[model samples]
Target: MKEFNALVVDPVGLHARPATVAVNAASKFKSEIKLSYKGRSVNMKSIMGVMSLGIPTQSEITISAEGEDAEAAVQTIEEVLKTQKVIA
Candidate 1:
């Protein structure tokens, strides 16, 4: 398993646009990826699940992946989040 933490930097937080980007990114991987916030965790590939968390600005989030491409999955998600300015 591989995991990394990030702080949401977007003023609007992880809204639909960023959440869609994240779900799209996670769907490309074969690994099981999860996003966690405020003690709740959801499948990163599911936009509904992610949005359900209602992650807000400055919130700490944990992304974790398990399986063959765990490391790559986590890295890709981290990059996507950063590029989208959803996290720093």
Candidate 2:
């Protein structure tokens, strides 16, 4: 498994837009991706799961991926987070 933490930068936190962006990218990969915030964890490929976390702005969340494309999946997801200003 590979894991990395990203700080949410968007003013609205990890809301619908970022959740959609993340889930869209995550679903393309074979790797199993999970996102954790505080004490709650959810599947990255599911939009509801991510949005349900209610991650606030400036909060740090850890993303973990495990599988053949874990590294690439993490990199791709990280890029989206950065592009969406959801993570820094």
- Give the candidate number with the greatest TM-score: 1
User: What overall lDDT, based on C-alpha atoms, would model 2 receive against the true structure?
Assistant: 0.92
Model 1: how far residue 86 lies from native, Å = 0.8
Residue 87 in model 2: shift from native, Å? 0.9
lDDT of 2 at 65: 99
lDDT per residue for candidate 1 within 1-87, as digits (tens), equals 899999999999999998998899999999999999989999999999999999999999999999999999999999999999999
Q: How close is candidate 2 to the true structure, as a TM-score?
A: 0.96
lDDT tens digits, residue span 18-87, model 2: 7898899999999999999998899999998998899999998999999999999999999989998888
TM-scores for candidates 1 onward, in order: 0.98, 0.96
